[model samples]
Target: MVQINFAQKQVNAKIVYYGPGMSGKTTNLEVIHQRAPEPNRGDLTSISTDGDRTLFFDFMPLDLGTVAGMRTCFQVYTVPGQVYYNSTRKLVLQGVDGVIFVADSSPDMMEENLESLRNLQENLSEYGRSSEEIPLVIQYNKRDIPGALPIEVLEEKLNQRGAPAFEAIANTGQGVFPTLKALAAAVLDSLHKSSGSSVPASAPAAQPVAAPQAATAQPSAPAPAAAPAPQRQTISMSQTGFHKAPSLPLQGAAAPSEAQAPDKGARPPQNAATTPGPQALGGLQLKGGSEGDGGGLRMAQPATPPAPEQPPTQPSLSMAVPPQPPAAAPAPTQAPPATATATAKPQTPPANRPATPGSMMRPDGGSPPPRRAPASKSFPSKVQEAHATPKGGKPKSAALTVLIVVASIGLGAALGSFVLQIL
Candidate 1:
């Protein structure tokens, strides 16, 4: 599990990209790693085997400036896309703070996407998390392709649980950064909300929370565009399957208004189209935990009620404190050493005691017949004889060898010859 050190003032969260094989999961990571400011991201790692492309998930760390005077870092991951690697996928999801479902946009990939979503649910449940509670985002990748399925259909099938979804072309950085930013914002927002009112809402545009904390802050009022600030970008309507909605004019520096959110979706675009990512995904309302409070411990505060417009569902990502080891049991006390008891001197047997035919007198007063233990095998005698051979090498060795052979012969001869002698 990833741990964010509040002591250092850093908030770290894990965001996983999950979906069917070849749905551009890796591509999404590649795009984000490339576009993410160099200092904020880490190296991208991949493991390809005959069965699946990823032996282990790819990790990319993004430095989302700062929040509440703390450094916020996001580690992005992608589960192995192959279906057979479900076990590995679940392991990757173990401590996930957020999820991005990168769905294949082609109509033919529908069944695969559906199965993948199911796999995600089962795996998350195994880890005691529901897709509902966790901050979840979807990227319908491959929008640049010709035969992409309708976004509405993809959403209907994959987003029945009602999480944020984005349409993107991950290869060319189209909706990639926006998708990443949305998840990052949601993750940081969750942390702040859980951390309580001390977090600054406008920190996203400020200095980095840094390696965990160490940020400069003036405690100014939240940026006017901050609360529900929309990340802006240029877009062409034809890319979204609209036949005639005119391409949005590129405004020199205007930001998106609350009313201009993109439509719902479940995947990111597959290729490099560089169009703006979806803003609708940002509208997803997470249940409050603590940040809304003036500043409180997470344990003492309860989760805020879901918004009236959005019904409550299970959490897709949840945090479980690793069970603490039970306190060590008290060491057992050793009793004082037993006092030495004066054992009575064993009584000597009477000198005049009579010896029976099969008995012997004991040193103790009691006169008991000697008990004969059961006879041991005769092999011990032979072994003794073999060891008793003298130092004269040839004579002793020959004698010992000859004695063994003679003993065998005599053993057989005695049965017959000894019988004649006894007769």
Candidate 2:
């Protein structure tokens, strides 16, 4: 049986080892407990099963790390193979999700293996579970013994259920882990399939609720819920992974625009490449073409989106780079961004060089020198003007008054000379 604890987010399952006495059932659990990592396994426990002993332990296998969103864990229990412990075997097998039937490979013990096999099927039937229904695996242990029975002979009699079988020498820990891993995988696989088959059976019960809701005020709200009316966390299992979902409290679908994101996968390239001008760099490569194509591609992506902000700048850029026409088209488009860059750098005007060739030029090819001459003086002249002025505005006003005073003195000297000559 499988128990899911929602609070702990853990799935618990049980697997029992069944076989004849001295068939290596106890050795299997001992080998796994000793070899398994300390944190991965719990304490090895012993139970007194009427004069004989039984062993069991808990383990977390990383190969089956998580199912759905919950951790998967299992307890391995071994039953005494002695025929007298029939009641104890039934008690152990009560809720078993899976079984690993370990058979002794010695030629002398073949009869004991067959008896244990019959006993296992009889005990399973008492609990109302079919031997064919539950997950089962067969392991032929003691393969390293001299003149051991052949694995083919063991499988011919023991594997009537068509379960996966393995040969092991459990005392030396040769095949212990593989046997346990195979059994854990089978258990989870059965749990998933059983859960899936039951989902549709409960769906019809939800269908009749729609008729009563339709007679109420909110018919449309409950209409869609009738579809797959019994909702649960779907369990999905494969060689790649296992997912066992549970009754989640609440969940929401993505917005319609976000849900349609994958449909737009063919969108960005169409929009980005439209302005790059027909693969100016062909897939066929030359030494120079690779760099030019890569650079032009890198430059065009950023330039294209912002081109909408200032549509006028591209023509000036195209006109400015006429000398390099054979170069790819995207390089010229990149220059449109230099309008702000050109204005900022004009303070440190170049003597004859254009301040960024693309931004300073016009489409008509006129005023090449006129625009370049004045834009170069970006900063130094402002300090020279502040040093020349005495309170800046007062210096201009004082010069006009000094010119008027000098004119009055010249007129008075001319009148004095005329009076002296008359006397």
Highest lDDT: which candidate?
1
Backbone clash tally (model 1):
32
- Expressed as tens digits, the lDDT of each residue in 1-423 for candidate 1 is 346797989878898999888787866775565345556665444433321245457665777677658887788888888787788889999889878888887888899999998888899999987876676666777665555777667766876654445565544334554455555655656655444476664544321111212112122112233521222111212332222212212222112111111221122221111222111111112221111211110000112221323211211222233444444312111111121111111111122222222111111112121111011011011222333434466788889999999999989898889889999
Give all TM-scores, in the order shown: 0.49, 0.44
lDDT of 1 at 352: 21
User: Model 2: runs farther than 4 Å from truth?
Assistant: 48-68, 194-423
> Worst lDDT window (10 residues) for model 1?
370-379
**Please, what are the lDDT tens digits per residue for candidate 2 over residues 1-423?**
887788888888888889987676765765564445455665444332211133222122322346678877787787866676678678889789888888887888889999999998899999998887876667777665556787656756766544555565554344455466556655655555555565443222211111122111111111221321121111111110211111110123122122111211101111221112212211111010011111111111111222112211111112244554454543223343333211111111123322222212111111111111111111112222323434435866777778777877777887889889998
Off by over 4 Å in 1: 50-52, 65-68, 192-423
CA error at residue 335 for candidate 2, angstroms: 98
Candidate closest to the true structure, highest TM-score: 1
RMSD over all Cα atoms, model 1: 32.3
Weakest 10 consecutive residues of candidate 2 by summed lDDT? 281-290
